[model samples]
Target: MFDGMVKIVLAGPVGAGKTTTLRSLSDDEPVSTEMPLTDGPMGEKTTTTVALDFSTVMLDDGTPLQMFGLPGQDHFAHMRPIILQGALGVIVLLAADQPDILTMCSEWLDAIQSITPDTPIAIGITRSDQARDFRMDALRALLAERKTTLPVFTIDARDREQAQQLVRALVYSFA
Candidate 1:
């Protein structure tokens, strides 16, 4: 069994499934600071995470993991660093169907890297099933352009197995 807890931050644009991913991986009830969405173009979804989401999960090796999901909306961007404090790694989620996927990815990556330059990062492309022409190449090229190469996975945020895989990848990157 591994000793101590590892903190990981999950960040992405609004509606990228950060909360859903946490819920999938958490062993306990996840605490979320979600409130009804009053603005923005988020269709169908009524609530938004105003602060953060917190959850805990124990790995197979008994390492307790503290998972924190950052609020995706730009107005809450200030909370990113606060939530990311002392995190061992970061998981960036992007909806495959988003028209601005590249930009969104770049923005989140920049923010995380700026705060924790050496922190391992894993990118998870969510909503792949809804994207007809999902372009992994584009994302890879973006990472390459930034002079960084990291594990990128296509995942369904609501799938426990997929979400766990993301967490595993982030942990393994620390090796």
Candidate 2:
């Protein structure tokens, strides 16, 4: 929402790949706020983002995209508004392997929209390849139920091209 910088936030629950996506998409190593998981681990994750992960990348047109990846746990939610204050868009990443992913996705959307209702958002369902019988239609149906349509993609958050697509789609969604 600023004049020259394009700020976007990547958000999701634990193990949703927000950090990995940031690292994958950034040319330079992201400034990560990871710490040992004294709390119980989610999946194979041994650490969690206590605050946020940050990086800046130049888009194809050379626009500077200042990306902030939010911590997945609810406890760190207080940081959301700080990261989102002037964000142009948000890319919510959901891990397909998570139980009740539909509900989680909906919650993330609600949380983001509650703060920045007009911000363009794109959804990326990560780790679909690791989930058996993951039905993307369910997510689509959930969005439909919300009476909204958003760009959604099943992506590997570890892949650069796929992560960049989510970013590009978020920017172009409002263009």
Top TM-score prediction, candidate number: 2
- Candidate 1, residue 140: CA error in Å? 0.7
Runs with alpha carbons beyond 4 Å of true place in candidate 1: 1-5, 59-63
Clashing residue pairs in candidate 2 are none
Superposed by TM-score, candidate 2 places the C-alpha of residue 150 at a distance from the truth, in angstroms, of 0.7
Q: Write the per-residue lDDT of candidate 1 for residues 80-122, one digit (tens) a residue.
A: 8887878888999999999999999999989998988899999
Candidate 1 total steric clashes: 0
Could you tell me every candidate's TM-score relative to the true structure? 0.92, 0.92
Task: Report the poorest 10 consecutive residues by lDDT, candidate 1.
Answer: 37-46
Error of 1 at 31 (Å): 0.6
Residue 49 in model 2: shift from native, Å?
A: 0.2
lDDT of 2 by residue, 148-170 (tens): 88999999888899998997897
lDDT, model 2, position 83 = 89
